[model samples]
Target chain A: MGLIQRVIEAAGIATIGISIVREYAEQVQPPRTVFLKWPFGHPVGEPHNRAQQRAVVEESLRLLYEIDTPGTIVDLPFAWRRHDYSAWDQPAS
Target chain B: MGISRWKNQLLALLATRFPALAKKFTDSYTPRASTGDIPWVRPAVPLHRAKLALVTTAGIHHPEQQPFDMQDANGDPSYRAVDGDRLFDNFTITHDYYNHSDAGKDPNIIFPLDRLKELVAEGKLGSLAATHYSFMGHIDGQHIDTLIRKTAVEIAEKLRQDQVDIVLLTPG
Candidate 1:
């Protein structure tokens, strides 16, 4: 996924990736990434968790604009199945 | 399912349940270390005014589309172009490398098209590109070259032609 992100970014479009595996993101070093400590196949969040999903999307998009350093991977603060996403608000742009 | 496919599925389930086991699996597969300068680009527009697109490695596709090849030890480098408007109406996930039962129930966990739509409706985002791209994430061996050199490049061109201002990539 990071490799593909690199290609797309090199093509001149900004790219941000949601990575469940931090090692892969570190190795491939895509321009911008948000690392979630969730299980594989659930990078955004758990199934049907609307607030969780929206929060992840909002954070990634926010980082897309905020991350200026290349190869920056922001570790998201949500805990899997533990964090309360109901109060998760969109990050202020 | 073939023997290898079944084995992969079992492994995926175990990995999902055990983070330590997942780390071992990731440690086994070494992605190509990116050299030289890491690619960089700023968003052409702000989030609320930018045309966004999704590019995922979740192995999702329309049911009528051919499933990703599971026979190869090296994963498929091919991509499926998905229509954003109608994707959730009918879709299929073809990845053996992840336990997709959860994703199968609600693909928003991986693709999040519905969540993005809500953002658009709320004026939090500009709009979504009509088309999105999907690929299987477990590419290895010679297929990595194909992905970097051919398929990824092709998708980048397609995104450019679509006038996407930013891309959000998700993985399986």
Candidate 2:
């Protein structure tokens, strides 16, 4: 996403990326990014939550004019409603 | 138990106790590098009037478009052009790395096709670009040059042709 984000921005089009992984987002910083510490494969939110998805999109778009810094990454206020992390059977360390 | 869960727990514990050591340990194996220069573009117009488009790395493609090649272990770096005029009825995912079971049921989770159109209807966004794009995120670094040079150039042209003002990228 970072690579493509850069490409689009370079083409004179603005872009904002919603990232599931903060590590990668920080390294390949795009012009604007929404960092949702939510688990992988669900960047927008859980499967069919329309309200949450719309809120996420609104917040991301809001960053377009709110942020002036080139690589600003604002962490969104959201958490997984489910405690399950997919590897529930794995022994806890 | 798989090694990944254990590793993640150990990393989390180390991060709390020995922060420096934890970072070193994590950084040792996964040396981070920027994919390309981050280019900045100020919005020429207000977002409500700007043309918007969606992009994803979840390997989403139109039902008729050719699916991403997952046979190659190295992965495919190509992207697909998706129509942005309406909500997608169905999308095919060829990415094997991510757990897309739910995405199969509802692609808007990753692509946000429905949400995008909703925003347009609400007049939150000015308009939707004529086209959108998707790519498989599992490609190896060996094709980084091609992806950045060739594929990116191609996608940029499409965005330009559509006069897109803002691109929302959903990285699955």
Point out where model 1 deviates above 4 Å. Answer: A89-93
Top lDDT prediction, candidate number: 1
Per-prediction DockQ: 0.70, 0.36
Two-chain complex of model 1, DockQ on C-alpha atoms against the true structure: 0.70
Cα displacement (angstroms), candidate 2, residue B87, comes to 6.0
TM-score (C-alpha, index-matched) for candidate 1: 0.97
Give model 1's docking category.
Answer: medium
Model 1 Cα shift for residue A8 (angstroms): 0.4
Give per-residue CA lDDT, model 1, range B13-87, as digits (tens): 999988789987777688888999999988988899999999999999999999999889899999999999999
Classify candidate 2 by CAPRI docking class. acceptable
Q: List the residue pairs that clash in candidate 2.
A: none
Give me the candidate number with maximum DockQ.
Answer: 1
